[model samples]
Target: MHKRTKSNIAVMLVLALCLSAILAGCGHEPDKPKPTKNVVLISVCSVRADHMSCYGYRRQTTPRLAEFARQCVVYDNAFTQWPKTTPAFCAIMSAKYAHNNGVLRATHGPRLADEHVTLAEVMADAGYQTAAFLSSPALAAHSNIAQGFQNVDEVFVGPRRAVLPTIRAIEWLRKRDPKKPFFIWAHYNNAHYPYRASGIPNPDMFVEDQFYDASRHVRALKDPRAHLKADVPRDHPCVMEILRPDIGAIHTWAVLDERPEELDFYIARYDAGIYSADASIGRLLDELRTLGLLDNTIVALVGDHGESLGDHNYYFEHGRFPYDATAHVPLMIRQPRGAGARHVSTQVAAFDLAPTLLEMTGLTPPEDWDARSLGRLDKDTPGDNLVFTEAGYQLDYMLAVHDSEWKLIDVPNALDRQMMRHQEYELYRWRDDPGETRELSAAHPDQVARLAAILDEWAAPWRAEVYANWTRNQTTIPTETSRQLESLGYVGSNSSEDEEGDDGGD
Candidate 1:
């Protein structure tokens, strides 16, 4: 009987051991690997945030984009670091301000310095198939914006249309390995200057030929050698007849006495361009959906810089100043897996895009980058960080510092006597006066002094870096590229002495 009891006890111990092994098995399972994601970044040239319906603009200038915004995170107060193509893009790709990237002027410096690590390089390092399709000569391969990109297409030089780049991107997407992740940076230039009224067909209202002719004449006046001339004074009946009726008295560089109606016509043409560009973006999005890539890809649409469009006496261009008209741009991001739609009111800068993108893709940004990741933003978050902007060539420099509420524009005394004669410092409460119509520097001396001091401190490092690496020698642009740029009203001369005039701003 004792022997039988011992055998029963051993059996009970074996059963208990089996139960423990089963519990251990149930408690844990192997982790599944995370799915790889693709990233597509589209940078539209000369897009103003306020012009889109999504931003509360009355016009249906961007119906497609409005719809797209419904599925992405739309930043309401996104501003560019610089209001020019090359410099702005340098900021976007390098995650550094233009001043730090050493590409302050459009044509003044060599391509973005080799030291600055680019977004493409980071993606490539992480095994991404990187490609870029650029629509502007200002971002040509020689410009070094193509660094670390496996496939770079700068062939689309004239007219700044979006169709060709979209097609190229589609082809590249198809050719890429399906198993590996990819990154594409496509730039669209349709919303750029020299508005083509002809592109928009059968609009609700048509601009008269006289107004179009006048625009051409005004552009010709910028050329010192053009045969065309405005024989009549700007206020003469001949010019006034084409001016819009609603346009009140306003200052403009095109002509001193432009009619409100004429300005409206010009604006209408710009809106048409925006509509066309928005449609192109819609097509690209549709293609992604068709390929079943939309669900797994992170798509970001941003404007390199905003167009002035006759704001603050700056007409039909950018880069002359750091006003909201030129600095504020549209920034929208659609995350993978339907992250849902949200609007961020916090002020964000263009340089922040690169770092934000890296973080979204589960990658780490370089510690030295000036841009901070925007991934932490949420509905309850408040923006208290200051954003800085700078643009100039040679002796003429304009710097702006702003937060959500206040903005300060500082134009230092330069060799150009005319610019010096104007207000050296202009302060505005941006929230109260979005148009920046009034200068409050005289009214609030303390505020101006405070903001100016902050701007100076923030800019000290960039200023010192740019000065140390300054190169006076001109970059040798390809002949074809120069011709294309000149045709687009970018550069006036090929001579190195004329580099300052190249101001490939918008």
Candidate 2:
């Protein structure tokens, strides 16, 4: 009996040893750590900072954004490198000025060169999955805007609304590798011109019967030149009809001309579109939370550019001028793990976004990048006060520089003779005269010269290389893309040069 017991014990000991060896092998294998963070960049096109309620606007156009801002670092004064879509996005992605990226124009010749490193490239190189869902045809894959994105979806069938894109983004997020980080860029194109008021709350708040007539008449005007190309003839039938007593009465009561009231109506429509966009964003945020990804994700909301809304006599759209109306955009950043909300009033450029995001993600930005991280902005960190802007489309070549209190705009000889007749230099104490109605150039000759010198020195290197590079690698957009751009007032001929009859601006 004792011998039998010893044999049984030996057999049991061998089985225990086998089990211990198996457990040790399993423990030796490395355990994969869960990805700590994800990034979602939401770019809202043509969204004016002033229109949002959080920016002191009376309208509740962005209740959702207002709530989101509570958990974000809200930037009250954020400016774009260029007001147009392509150039502005390039600046954000490349962390470079328009000159460095060599994308001066909205379309036609200047495309984002291959040499420059994009934000997508940087993230992808760092082992993050990069994807982009663009609503604007101006940012199509062929535009070289798809440089480092592993996946790009620009094929939303109808008017580029936020709903479809947001849905697609959520779906992509659900399928993304749980163990890997991701960088997703989604562009919302709702606040653009030809504003659709469908599904907007309180669409009739600013509605006037005559305003509708004026809007319809303005839309019916066949002459493309009358719309955004240039100032319409005061005596033209469209103008006369709009200014007629039946249509102009409500408009003329506030301002001497019909323009002020007409603009009021247009602004109402624009606000409605903004409201819709805000709702869509709220939906996206909610979905992220529902999917248990909100806390681990970094949410950034910004505008590519703002609409003019009749500022500087340039009505309806953006990209035409360098006024605060178009240049100043809203920027909001929500860090992972519920970082507390803070408002940053420092004047920062859109290019700073790339570096800021990189630093936030525990990555190092390239030293040569024009953008600097705003990581210490909450600590009252001091940075370069100067913000530069440029526009080189068909209207007029413009360069501008602005500090906290002053702004200087230099319009080189216009491509069109009519535009050339306008002033070549404009200086404004923007703090006092936010409208930029008063030109202080003559009054402040010394300041003008000083700013001009700065601009010239800054632009010299870019000017030397831009034209040559643009001519060397011009991209011809597809016919379908051209038609889409034309519908959005980016009309031009099909040639590699400037589109014919394309009085480029916003």
Candidate 3:
């Protein structure tokens, strides 16, 4: 009887252990690894936030971008540290001010120093497949603007639109390694100067008045009698005999004389360029969606810097002034799965982009970077942050200190001039006077003093460091690069003797 009981107990115990194992398998499964997210960064040159349809422009210049804005975390008051392409991009990629990053001027500074780790390097280190497709010749590999990117293509160099880059980016995406996450940067120069409005089949539809093509304007400037046809009425500004071949110079001369009516045509052309860029961006996004990667990829769109558009007597150019028209740019980030869509009015700088992107992608930004990540922005965030904008060689090292309500433009040109005894300051209540028509430096002495002190404290160290190593920081511009700059109407010297005629560094 004892033997029989022992056998029965053994059988029952075996069945209990099997049941426990089955229950454990059914109740809880092991944790699966999280999928890595991909990233795409899109940048357009010379785009003014106010002129974009998504940013409250009356014109529908960026219908596709406006649609994209709905899926993005749009930053309404974002600003760039520098107004020039190379320096601005340096600030964005290095998460450091231009002066600190060693690329303070376009076509002049040494390629971004290898010492500072770039966003591409970080992404690459984090196991990302990095690539950069840029449309600006100024950003060619020789300039080191594509630092740390494994694959780079600057085939469509010049002021071309986003078409070629978009196509190339799509092809790269299709052929990229499916197992590894990728980081792709596509920079478009469509909205930049000459404002040719090229990809649009019918630009006249976007213009309020007659469409004046860029070539027509250029021809008229070269030889008024032969090129300026009767269509260019006597009342039109282009009818005037301007010796300069660059449209920007002629536009500056005309607008300064209060002949701004013709500017409307140019503005319309600029809008059309934005429209072309928007369409190209739309196509790229559509491709992402088609490939089943839209939800998994983070899409970041921004303007490297804003165009002057005749503001502050700086026409059709940037990097010459630190006004809001040139400093304020469009910044939007489409989070993965279209999450976190909201407008952030808190002031932010281009440098913040690097760290923000790094944080969003689950990577850690370098501890020594001068930027703070904006990934945690919310509706109640304070707007008290001070954003700084620095001028390039064109402005003789000017700086603008901005707060939520006031902006102070400090031009220390006197330091370089033997005859001048005092610095120049221009203060404006930017909130109430966005146009900045009324100067307040003379009226608000206290504000100027306070802001000036802040500006000097913030800029002094960087300025000292930059000038201390000026010779080592300069680079020789290649002949082909000079030709590219000339084609884009961005060639000139940084000599005070030729300051009156110099127009290229920016």
**TM-score, model 2 to reference:** 0.79
Model 3, position 148, has a per-residue lDDT of: 79
* Model 1 lDDT tens row, 1-506: 99999999999989977877776689943332332789999888888888887788777778888888888989888888888888899888998876667676554334787778999999998889999988767788657878889998864543434466777888888888998999998887766644442224533233453324334322213322332122334432112212211112221222212333356665766666677677777778888888999888999988878877656655676665788988888998999865967998788887788888888888888887988887756533464668788864433367888877889988773421233237778898987888888878889999899898988888776665554454532366677766555443334432212222221323
Poorly placed runs, candidate 1 (over 4 Å): 1-35, 158-160, 197-223, 226-261, 378-381, 394-396, 414-421, 464-474, 488-506
For model 1 the local lDDT of residue 53 reads 79
Backbone clash pairs for candidate 1 read 243-262, 244-260, 244-261, 244-262, 247-260
- What TM-score does prediction 3 earn? 0.79
Worst 10 residues of 3 by lDDT: 494-503
Q: Which is the better candidate, 1 or 2, if ranked by lDDT?
A: 2
Give the least accurate 10-residue stretch of model 1, judged by summed lDDT. 237-246
lDDT of 3 by residue, 108-193 (tens): 43578788888999889888999998887667665676877999987554333348878889999999999999999998877765
Q: Per-residue lDDT for 228 in model 2? A: 28
**Model 1, residue 418: displacement in angstroms?**
4.0
lDDT of 2: 0.70
How do the candidates rank by TM-score, highest first?
3, 1, 2
On residues 1-506, what C-alpha lDDT tens digit does candidate 2 reach at each position? 99999999999999977877787788853433333578899988888898889787777789998988989989888889998788898888888887777676565534678888888888888889988887777787656867888999884336434466687788888898888899998888777655654334564554553434454322222233332234445532123212211111221111212243454566766777788778878888998889888878889988888977656545565565778888889999998655967887778887798888887787778877898887756565334578898863432367888877788988874432233226778898876886678888889999899889989898886665564444433577778776665543344422212222121222
lDDT of 3: 0.72
TM-score of each: 0.79, 0.79, 0.79
